[model samples]
Target chain A: MTKPLLTVEGLVKRYGEHTVLNGLDLTVREGEVVVIVGPSGCGKSTLLRCINALEPIQSGAVRLEVAPISRESRDLPALRQKVGMVFQSYELFPHLTVLDNVTLAPRKAQKRPRAEAEREALALLERVGLADRARDYPRQLSGGQKQRVAIVRALVMHPQVLLFDEVTAALDPEMVREVLDVLLDLARQGRTMLIVTIEMNFARAVADRVIFLDGGTIVEEAPPEEFFDHPKTPRAQKFLNTFTFDAVKRPHPSSLADPTT
Target chain B: MSIAVLRDYLPLFARSALLTVRLGALGILLAVLVGVLCSAAQYFRLPVLQQLSAVYIELSRNTPLLVQLFFLYYGLPKLGIRTDPAVCGVAGLAFLGGSYMAEAFRSGLEAVDRVQLESALSLGLTNAQAMGSVILPQALSISMPALVANVIFLLKETSVFSAVSLMDLMFTAKDLIGLHYNTVESLTLLVVFYLLILLPISILGSLVERRLRYAGSGT
Candidate 1:
């Protein structure tokens, strides 16, 4: 088995007498896509936020592979540069043009030159299908376009791991698929991703593994086939039952997969 | 009524106007410097400096400017500190204006979003660098209108210097009225003189406010 690119051990988070994440543990192998799903306030977002030190945990350890030196310990800003995040709200700098937003951290943080940074920024924007929107401010973009720009903004840092906190949650239904398509493309490109998403269908299609959380605990986790088909725990069965009727009635593309081949 | 009277006193008026302009400029410069430094000290959570700045701001802001001026000009001498009337007047205005300017800057700094600061930190900029590069530019743009308005107020407040025998615009007007027994005309000329100086400052302040608004909206 390959070495895990990222690891979390006994992660615990609380908010003034309320436990949000209760000793959760997980790992992601290099180039793996792991999806986390849960109801609101279930700590999926908190879990992702902790990996990048956006929210410090009470007691846990997150280790990332920093290149060149390959240090195991977490230096948060360095870790953050390696582990990029895409917020649900897009969170683009409203005052900056799209190009500047993408280039800002690279230039200021990484000390990259203007021409080189712009070159990388333009490429990332093009990859997200937003090269033409470079000079435009975020407010000028649609919900889908803004989210895509946000993805590109993170990607421009060349991060080793990407965390998505329901990147499509704020978008309109029609706009959801566009942003998800970008994520699927990134997944196909072999980027390690930890995604907190409500779209179970997308999770079933793309995730190598799925973890379900309830009341700040991991209720179940397994490969997509086993997790969805033969969930062992009662909470997992009940959770899967919510989507089982629709999964049967609708023509899910997974049913068409060549099981024999 | 007499052209000779006008001709005779025109140089003195000009000299006094020069003095008034110098006092206003120096006082405002010092006020802004003190205000920015004190506000920054408060912002960075400096231990003793923050408390001292807060106390200074409160005392200066709450007390009457006249009393503060009297304290500087009259009381300081009793404490064996003898400074020129011009120096005392400028010091008084600077102290008073610094309090108001500090409040203006504090509000401007507060107006910035917390997320912007967080993003700056995430980008590897130090706290001070983030403030200077990302936060302060935006805050200054936000605070420019208030600062400009304060300048006009400071300019007008320079009138208080006349009470300390600084021979500023109002002082000269009083002297001319006392010598010529033309109280009504002298007071009217003083009012016109002030209007001449303050009207331009008011217009300039509005222009700066408009520019900042446009930049904020345009961005």
Candidate 2:
């Protein structure tokens, strides 16, 4: 069997008295799209942040396949270049144009030349369908457009794994689809992604695997068809019942037991 | 009312004006350099240096400028440190200007968001590089209007130096009034002299404040 592209073992995080990630273990194969679905405040965002070292983990090992030779862990900055993240807030540098924001990290941190980084940024922006908004500042763009620019900014670094932390949480209901479409395109391109989202239809359409998290632990993990159709945990069933489930036609796994007889 | 008297005293007044301008320029320059250094030290939280700068600012700001000038010019001589009256004037102005400048800079530093510094660090910039390239530029822009005000105040405060026996503009006016016993004419010339220097500074300060406000808004 091929080794997984990224592996996390016993990942744990805490904030004073409260533990957020409770020894979560996950592995992603190369080019796989994994979606993490959870209720609000269930450590899904914290898990994604920990993967990129944006939030410090109390204890655990995150190993990437790219650095297979060294068992010794590297620092956060080195790991960050390999795992790019898209935030819910779309934290674009306010002073820079969209093109400059996309190119800043590649040019400054990665030491790529200005011309080369600009070309890559333009191409990525084109991919995200925001080519015309390149010269505009973040404040000038709509919420959807800013999120697309942020995705392109992260993509410019050419990271091996991408982490999406509620990328559509801040968008207007009408604008959410545009941002989701760009992410779907990236997923189709065979990029490894770990997305944390509440968009059930989008997750069901694009994700090969879905992990439902609650109370600081992974409650269920399986292919979307099996997990959504036959949710084994009582918590997962209760959680799914809260959402308007008619958007996706996928049947619940335990639906047969709902007979009126 | 004699033409000979007007011509002779006019030359003296002109000479004293030159000396006044020279002293004011040099004093403001020294103040700017010292103030910037002291402000930076305090802002960066350098331990002993911050305490020293705070003490200096408090002492200079609280005391009267006239007394400070007397202390530097007269008190220093008692301690066997004899310097020229012009040097004493410059030192006193610089000391006073530095105190006000420090507060201006402290507010400027405080106005910058801490996130900008964190973003710089995330981009692999060292602490000093981030401070020099990112923080200081914004801080300096924020401080410019207040700094200009301090410069104008320092220029006007140079009159205090006349008490220490420096033949600056005020001293020249005093000498002419004493000799000719025309206090009204001499004091009127002195007022005009100050307005000439101070009006331009006030105008420049407003212009710079407007520019900085525009730049800040555009960003």
Candidate 3:
């Protein structure tokens, strides 16, 4: 019954002859955690990028809170202010300190005073237990720490929705847990999030709905339990089967909630 | 080889040194300004400027510095465009150095992960703000060693100012040689003067290079 916070309608994106996203449509209500998983090169990352307006769609529309998101119709920076995206390769500004990195957008885009920006940034860093590392540079931190700092950077803007484009893909196996814990905490805090990840367990634990995409279209969508335990589509079954029996497995992504509760 | 030669020429050398420093500083500054515009134009594919930048970079980079100097200093006068010799010489160096500077800048900008721009945009920074605040700084750090090397090259090449009749260090040395016929001594003194001016800059360049080594490569 609540208003949808985000909507993607008949979205189509292409790179020359190849179509990366094809006539995709979805809607998310406020505070829903939607996880997208598919085989490599299946347009999962492109879909998230299109939502953020980083990749311009060839047709269709993306809207946030009843407003159309288009290059011609909107002030992009202002639109971006409402939707924050964290990249797969933690693109932290290497030249600035971590504190500066967190505060740059607030100071520049929102024109917040320095002390106010730093104060807010410090609190967010403290939330992630990175307050002590505020003075360190991006190069000084590990992959997990850099991604965590990146998450805090996005949070400082108080965006309406957060997008993660495979944020844990670059991490060491040991480091993935630290970053996922942050995501789990954000989900528990009731934030609206769209995550593109291969961590089957994390999706199974936190996703309000799991979307299995193949060849640029959603093959199946359901609650995680139903989707994982009983994938209805042949494409979904095949995709999961490939990962189901690999010997060199990624460390298992721990569970988020105890279903019995 | 006596103390008198050193003492007598010190003031003149000081003045010539000042002149060289002033011209070198101005030329390098102009080169950097020209480089920023040219490389940005190329990156954005700005209509006419991009083509102009490409032609200018290639022409300047390929031609000998001496010919460019002669063309600007001498050829322009006959075309009813007389300009100051110092202006012509500085413009020439800037043109030549800027071409190389643009290459350095282009590479540096490319060295950055393209994802950086997307992230910056998502943070609500406008394209200009993203390029200026986030992208340009990393590019600068990566491009610095090449830029500094270009500057050192410019300082040495400013010796060509003598042919243009500009009062650069090499010009002053030529005049001293003409007056005293102490060719070896005067040239040796000029070399010392150049070393004194440029060695410190070389040291600073290396220091900066060391600091920036690991900064731009982080994820």
Interface RMSD of each: 3.6, 4.3, 1.6
Chain B global fold similarity (TM-score) for predicted model 1 against the true chain B: 0.91
Report the candidate with higher TM-score, 1 versus 3.
3
Number of the top-ranking candidate, with TM-score as the measure: 3
Question: What is the alpha-carbon lDDT for the whole of candidate 1?
Answer: 0.81
TM-score of 3: 0.92
Q: List, residue by residue over B1-219, the lDDT tens digit for candidate 2.
A: 455655566667777777888899898888888788888888789989999999999999999889999999889999999988888898988888888988888888887776556444444344565576557766777888888888888888888778989998899898888887877667766777778778988998888777664223122
lDDT of 1 by residue, B40-102 (tens): 988777999999999999998999778888999899999999989989988998999998899
Docking class for candidate 1: incorrect
Pick the winner on TM-score between candidates 2 and 3: 3
Which structure among the candidates has the greatest lDDT? 3
lDDT (Cα) of model 2: 0.80
> In candidate 2, which residue ranges exceed 4 Å CA deviation?
A1-18, A22-29, A51-79, A213-215, A226-229, A245-261, B1-219
Winner on DockQ between 1 and 2 is 1
Clashing pairs in 1: none
Per-residue lDDT, model 2, residue A32, is 93
In model 1, where do residues sit more than 4 Å from their true spots? A66-76, A236-261, B1-10, B41-52, B183-185, B214-219
Candidate 2 vs. true structure, TM-score? 0.72
Of the candidates numbered 1 and 3, which has the greater lDDT value?
3
- The local lDDT score (0 to 100) that residue B9 gets in candidate 1 is 71
Decreasing DockQ order of the candidates = 3, 1, 2
